[model samples]
Target: MGDVWAAGDAYEDYVGRWSRRVAVPFLRWLDVPAGKRWVDVGCGTGALTSAVLAWKDPAQVIGVDTSEGFLARARAQVSDTRASFRTGDARSLPLPDRRFDAVVSGLALNFVPEPHLAVAEFGRVAAKGGTVAAYVWDYGEGMAMMRYFWDAATALDPAAAELDEDRRFPLCRPEPLHQLWADTGLDEIAVEPIEVATVFADFDDYWRPFLGGQGPAPGYATSLDKEHRHALRDLLSTRLPTAPDGSIALTARAWAVRGVAGRPA
Candidate 1:
């Protein structure tokens, strides 16, 4: 299954809206002072970047992503003069060291091949005492939306288990995340669960995004043959807990981690 983030609008529809809910509390957790320079790594569709610009009042916000399509959409959606978008690797940020007062990423860390290296890079670009933070869905259990999808998918096809984010991204857990921060020499490292309500008006509202094939679950769904795909959909339809009015309400939880960049010894 292709996990590449090539489509902007599809992603925005699928996870970007839910991610914005997490971004607000995640930024509040950081509690950084206003007017500080910031860098948003993997700033997909500018959700986190836009929130930072609107709420934090940063002096400047540089948003970086590997996908040019995402960057283009970010630039178009976020018209603030203080915000700029660039195409760059998160593992090796293009900006100079110790330039930004805060470096943060949202819903993007789990996609990185080497999360520890990416966290180290965040530390490298952050000024001493700057805040470095990131948040990712708890794919193993708490991220109910994808957890339910994967549970249904794996029940039908065992091979699909390998593609599951829970199995694929072990670093998404709090222990590994906290260890990575401590190992990087970051100070006051901490991890917390950020929960948000994912309310869908109807089953179609929930199922339509999966057909977009932008994220892992959607990609896997589209990769299957018509028969198996329909079977999986049928199974999910029966399994999901739908309210009396046919609305589906679920909780999505993400593990948010933060630390302060320490001065070089």
Candidate 2:
């Protein structure tokens, strides 16, 4: 929970495709204004933060996360002088009151232990009328790639039933998210589902990323003993479709929620 391995493009290879196609578009929908101060919570590797930095032209853009390893990578990837990366917790941010005009996160909200408090913190840090928007991957049936993986895994080994999609993809549906916004005191909250297409060339291209041990599913696979890992790999490869021309296409979905920080009641 506290650390993520940042050794290579292994994380980038698989996760990056999804980030570019799904996460980026959902984040951009917030339409951050020029010269505003923006904060990106859980700014893993600065992928979403850098995208915000580019799109918003903010007076300053701060990227905050818990991982020193992720911060190091973020520092390297983001070259903007107006941007800075720091180690911080979302539940208890270090910044002062009403410090930002906008706050946004991408695909990191679900992993937070107390998402409600995190949302409240977003409201607290955002100035009056400032916007807070976040994106999380839709789980199970909505996200085709991950759904396919779990489906294939369960068929191979019922013990894999422990790997249910609901646990990870909590915001896949809208009701809980809408209620969360109301509980957090966000005014005029709205939620939208967005899709991104992920493309892979051949079996090796898709399989290698799971071996990287970056995110949750990949981390689970990498933790398995060699025999189990091999068995899982064989099951997945056999189950997933392979294109005649050596390409695979999968769709991923994210629920993007946005709202304004209304005046205190």
Candidate 3:
């Protein structure tokens, strides 16, 4: 199974904690209303789903992911009686049509083999005039931390170069997102760049998560043999700057997008 959710622990340990924090403000920006039903796609650990529940007293919040292990952890983190988690694929949602008032996804669309189809499903589930918004990590040169690590790691092993940042973070620029929104038949499309700072207590705090082998960078790290692992680690450490207290601070970009579902009349 290609289920990325199987990588739950490493995801939460490394990117999950920071990624959730960064997405909080974007959810607020969308103005999700109270008492509305919500679906959080790729809701690893329920971070974005939890954020939605916190702001809007949503009538219901369903967090969907492909990894049962991730769903288990997400269930534990979110104590809201109104919230629930499910294991499912993004391209095909199990919910009824027009059953939700809004659909919100975060940092997840990039991993889908067909993001456009997933977006259409998100739109399909939303009630007419309902909102659909999403964000993804910018994996190009400006994404910072991942960029730094990948640059260093790939240099050590040319074979580890198939990471799919480009396909996942495709909305980094405005034109592509604008085109995607149009293609999806969504109206009022808006796309913007959001910056988030990832803080680590130390370089070890930053490096430790890569050992989890959950996501792309971690997968690369875990795939290496003993000799290559040490070299990759050393190379990353050299590339990432350390703080006086031995912490690391890296910045990342998220492409935030929003639009209304259905034909743009």
Candidate 4:
């Protein structure tokens, strides 16, 4: 199944909001020093880029994405003069090699058609001793938000299993990520989990984002007919736990990996 990432506002509504929660801690895990140049590959809506600007105090950040719509919104949201948004592919970034102190992507690597090539590109643009890091939702289980939805959808329609992110993105897990870094020749490789709370005001707060059709789950949702969509929604509502205030609280976990960009031998 193809991943949808065309609209910025729709993306922000779907998963970008939660992505922000993971950014600060992801950057903290890297612990890169301030005033260093950074490149945010697949920097959709500027979530990670904004986090670096606010928390890491980077000298400059270039946010790249294939979608011009995402870049436009990122440019609008990030008013900082030090930040710039561009349209570029992850496998072949449009920038000079060995120029950045750090290269990072949030919730993006798995969406790349050839993640290994993208990882190499990240390594290519990073200076020696610079950090290369990325994080992706653990769609197999830890990402409760989509997990619940997919579980319900698959139960209702076994065909939905084909579209599940868990089945589609095996690289999101820790072991595979470690192997990727190792294969890329990056040194000091490490992987960890980052989880955040996602509390929705009500079922609608949780359900409305699915209608945005900007990601895998949403794409699956919008693909269904009205009757099937309603059935899936009803099934999810029954499965999820709601509080006294009719709010739903779930945890979203992402697998994060980092490594030092080694100098060419």
Best model number under TM-score: 4
- Report the C-alpha lDDT of model 1 over 1-265, residue by residue, as the tens digit: 5696878898988999999999999999999989999999999899999999878999999999999889888988999999998889999999998989999999998898888889999999999989999998999988888988999999999999999999999988999989989998899999999999999888888888898889889999888889998999899889888999999999999999999998656
26-47: candidate 2 lDDT, tens digit per residue: 6567776689998889887788
Candidate 2 regions off by >4 Å?
1-8
Off by over 4 Å in 1: none
Comparison by lDDT, 2 against 3, better one = 3
In candidate 2 the C-alpha lDDT for residue 51 amounts to 77
Between prediction 3 and prediction 4, the one with superior lDDT is 4
Q: How well is each residue in 64-100 modelled by candidate 4, as lDDT tens digits?
A: 9999889988999999999998889999999998999
Quote the lDDT for 137 in model 1.
91
Error of 2 at 248 (Å): 0.6
Task: Assess the local accuracy of residue 51 in candidate 4 as a C-alpha lDDT between 0 and 100.
Answer: 99
lDDT of each: 0.91, 0.77, 0.80, 0.94
Ranking of all candidate structures by their TM-score, best first: 4, 1, 3, 2
Model 3: how far is 73 from its true place, Å? Answer: 0.4
Q: After superposition, how far is residue 94 of candidate 3 from its true place, in Å?
A: 0.6
Root-mean-square deviation (CA) per prediction: 1.1, 2.2, 2.1, 1.1
Taking all chains together, the TM-score of candidate 2 against the true structure is: 0.92
